[model samples]
Target: MSRILVVEDNIGIRNVLEKTLKMKGYDVFSVGTGENAVRLFTSDIFDLVITDLRLPKMDGLEVLKKVKKISSTTIVIIMTAYGTIENAIEAMKSGAYDYILKPFSLEEIEIKVEKALSQQRISNENIILKEEIKSRFGWITGKSQKAQKVYKFIKKVSDRPTPVLILGESGTGKELVAREIHENSSRRNFPFVAVNCAALAEGVLESELFGHERGAFTGAHAQKKGRFEIADKGTLFLDEIGDLPLNTQVKLLRFLQEKSFERVGGTNTLKVDARIIAATNKDLKEAIKNKSFREDLFYRLNVITMTLPPLRERREDIPELIDHFWSRYTKELHKDMAITPEVKDILYSYDWPGNIRELENAIERIIVLSEDKVVSIDDLPMELREGISDIIPKALPDNIGFTERVEYFERDIIKQALEKCSYNQIKTSERLKLNRGTLQYKMKKYNLYCKKISTKS
Candidate 1:
């Protein structure tokens, strides 16, 4: 239930408000002085506060300011008489939700209270949605010290308007962090435009960043707005910012210094209120020393810096990340699959050079190729099996039960033959010296299949 506090020096008005609010199913608290209202507010949490503009101990505006200082999300409504309408307007300017003039009907009070609460509900829902987005985008992952530090820094700097430079190796989820920040900020409702600075040539990248006019270049057919214009009141993410040329860096620095730019081949200057987030895998400090990156531009973009640790540095998070991706791909591919302990040992032990992206791809490959409901050592790629075998001991321990030992031996034999025959079931059966029917039965019994992986290079 929503709680409301009514502060009016007039005893009759206070009683009327308390009775009407209670009849409307609200938990209403009535006070006759502004001092009492502040004291109660400091002690409790109220969703809304309705106060008269005139009070004996303190004024309504003072109460509003004090309550706002306590919590900006608290809703304040000002009540004024006929001659003090100016004071009510001032209250509104000072962060009041709405004003109710004297002699208001019960219906009017109800309508204003309902409207204010409705807005508060919408605001709360938006905050929850943003948090869900952050979790889904990989920001809220693992409890390692490094991961916790990153999360703390992200939360601390998300609401600020400074430019953030994400420095990490490729595939370390730099862009994910950038998107998380944008989603958590006030500008989340607007567009999030991204540009790959290393993919395009200098001329094309310039045109892409600042827009182009018709006949500006060979392929220019119409006037276009660049990422800056498109990301106005939102965020513009420049990936591989280290690959940006000197000339393009100058233009970007100018735009960062002043949120104004002109389209390519256009004379008119355009202004936009966009936040800049740049990411790169290169050593920008070294680049600066080599004179390939501008020192001034680096300082401007480096107002806030975030460095993501490599996967090898945070191996403790690998198992959790694998589980996360497994849940995702199993649902996406419409498969019910389970991985063996050996497979987990292998995945957890390997050094992921490509970080989270590579781990996700590895899981996706198994999901696509394995026909069985359970994943085994044979389902993994050759490198992972070899790496695991080299690292793990071969002897079966006394802790292993009989059925598990048999299953392990059978899975190991099948995986070896599959690796020898290049994952071809027909060739593997011929090499194993078993009938095709028997091979098929064993494969089904052991949850094994020789499906090949298909993906773009």
Candidate 2:
């Protein structure tokens, strides 16, 4: 149920509002002064506040500001007489939800109250949804102190319209950070366009950025709008900015300065408003020294910089990351799988050079290959196996039976073939020159037969 506080200096009006709202199923409290309303607010939480514009001790605008300070999400409606309508407007400017004339009917009050409550409900749902999304992202990215700092910095600069340069190694989620900034910004409703600068040649990259007119090139058949034009009033993420060609760099600098650019072979200088976010794994300063990347362009793009630390530096997050990826893959593959402590030990010890992407791949592989519920150390890849071998005993004791040794050998071969073929039994058996049924039998014997690979990508 919604709780409402009604503040009116007139005793009769306050009693009437309190009785009317109470009849409408709202827990209503009435106070004749803003000071008492504030005192009541301190003692109890309220969803809505209805206050008169002119009060005895404190005015409605002051009450509105004070209520917002106490709880910014609380809905406030200002009640004003004919002469005090201007004061009600001022209250609205100070964060009042809506203004109701003093002589309004019960029906008008009910409508305004219902609408305000609906808006508050919608706002609360949005906040909850955003928190869920942030929590999921935090789980996947490993919320280490370094990661938290990066998140804090992103929040600090998300609303600014300055250029942001993100530096991180490959697979360090630079583009993810860029998208996060865009999603949190004022222009989130606009499109977000991303272009891989290293993936295109000079001419193609230029055409992609600034568009081209019909007959501009050999294969040009129709006019085209480039990323800048497409991303107008939005954000354009340029990944691997260090690899951008010198000529394209000069053109980009001009566009950033003037917010305008001419299409290839077109005389018209089209203007657009676009926020540019650039990412690079290369040291751009060193590239400047090598005369490959332009210094002026670098400075123009480097107004705001954020760097992502490699995963090795945040090893403290490894266990949580492992659990996160394990749960994800298990859900995706529709399998009930668990990782053994020995496997976790090896995973924690090994340095993840490919970072989160690599760790996710490793988890997916384990999920796709492990038939039984538990993932053992034998299910790991060769590099991890070798790394684990160094920390444990290498030779088998003589007391161990031949059957156990054969089981270990069979498990190792199955894991190797699965790794090679990416857990496709047909391919693995074909490469092993064994019958598919025989391979399945062996895999079952060693508990390596995971769920069949889904045909859907």
Candidate 3:
């Protein structure tokens, strides 16, 4: 249920509003003054506030301002008479959701309160979405020293407004790193707008970064907000910043220096508080030497440089990433997918030239088209398997029957998983896609308990 605070100096109106709102299924809290409303808010959170314009001590406008300071997303509705209608408009300017005039019907109260709470619900959902984004792409797990450094730098600069330049080859997850930073920063609830600097022409790129007015150009039929304005108080990610033309580079430098810009055809200077995080696969320093990129703009964006290592450089993380994507795609596609040890070895052997993106796509593809729950070496994409000349079959003693052969294969894979997880039963079960109870039963049946293995991460 949504919580609402009704602040009316008139006791009769307050009681009626409180009763009417309660009938509409709101958690109503009534207060005769704005000061009391703020006090209640300081102790507890409310979804919406309904207050009269005139009050004995603090006015509705003051209450609205204080409410905003307490919680920026909280909705405030101002109540006023015809004489104070102008003040109600001023209250709207001060962040009031809407105003209700005096002598209003109970129906009017229900409509306004419902609309206000509905808007607040959408805002709350947006916050939850950002949190999900943070948990989704925010993880950059790896045992490599280079990956550790990226984690350290993300923690160091996540809260600051400094310009960040991410340098890496294509598919090295530069955009993922940028999203992780924004989602973990103070601007998590705000937008994280991204644009490819290389995808558009010189003029189109400028209009994209700084916005364009209607009739500003040939096809600009309506006023449009560019990445910067849309990302105000948030983050603007410039993907492939090295491909930005020189003219757009100059404007970007100016914004970095002045925090201001104008629409393509507008003369009024506009200002926004958006942080810039640029990424590129190209060698920007080389681009500068070749006169394709500006030295001044490069310096501005290079305040905090982060270079993501290629997937081949962090080979130890391949198995873990494979498992991560495997779990994600399996759940999303509603398939019970598992990879054979040979397939795992093949994936781990290949150098992922396209990096994490390629690896993720490969796993997703395998899960989607896999005929059975288990994905063997033959099920892997041809290109991925071409480098592996052959997966030599493991030699086993002569099988007396099919049941014995199946037991032997299960026992071998279980032993490998146990060793990989340092004999930690829980971790082994998870890695092998088996439940704990089932893995324990198999271990008991095969008598494959290792007392020498240490159960440590």
Question: Which candidate gets the maximum lDDT versus the true structure?
Answer: 1
Q: lDDT of each structure? A: 0.88, 0.86, 0.86
Model 3 earns a TM-score of 0.59
Ranking by TM-score: 3, 1, 2
Pitting candidate 1 against candidate 2, the one with the higher TM-score is 1
Q: List clash counts for every candidate, in order.
A: 0, 0, 0
The best candidate in terms of TM-score: 3
Task: Tell me the tens digit of each residue's lDDT in model 1 across 1-457.
Answer: 9999999999998999999999999999999998999999999999999999999869999999999999899999999999999999999999999999988998999999999999999998888666545544354777778888888887888889999999987778888888888877899889989899999999989999999999988889999999999999999999999999999998899998888889999999999999999999999999999999999999999989999998877766877888888887897788999987778878986787887778878988999999998898889988787776654547799999999998888777777777656778887887567888888888888878766688969
lDDT digits (tens) for residues 314-424 of candidate 2? 777888888877876787689997788778867876778987678778888888988888888878888778777543435678898998887776677676667657889
lDDT of 1 at 70: 96
How does model 2 fare in lDDT? Answer: 0.86
For residues 1-457, write the lDDT of model 3, one tens digit per residue.
8999999999999999899889888899999998999999999999889999999889999999999999998899999999999999999998999998888898988998888888878887887666445434324657667778888888888999999999988888788789988977999889999998878998888998899999998999999988899999999999999888888888899999999999998788999999999999989889989999999898899889988889888777888788877877887798987788788878886788888888888888899888997898778898986765533336667746888777777887788778767899998997678999999999999998987667888
Q: Candidate 1: TM-score?
A: 0.59
Identify the runs in model 3 with alpha carbons over 4 angstroms from their true place. 1-139, 390-457
In model 3, pairs of residues that clash are none
TM-scores of all candidate predictions against the true structure: 0.59, 0.57, 0.59
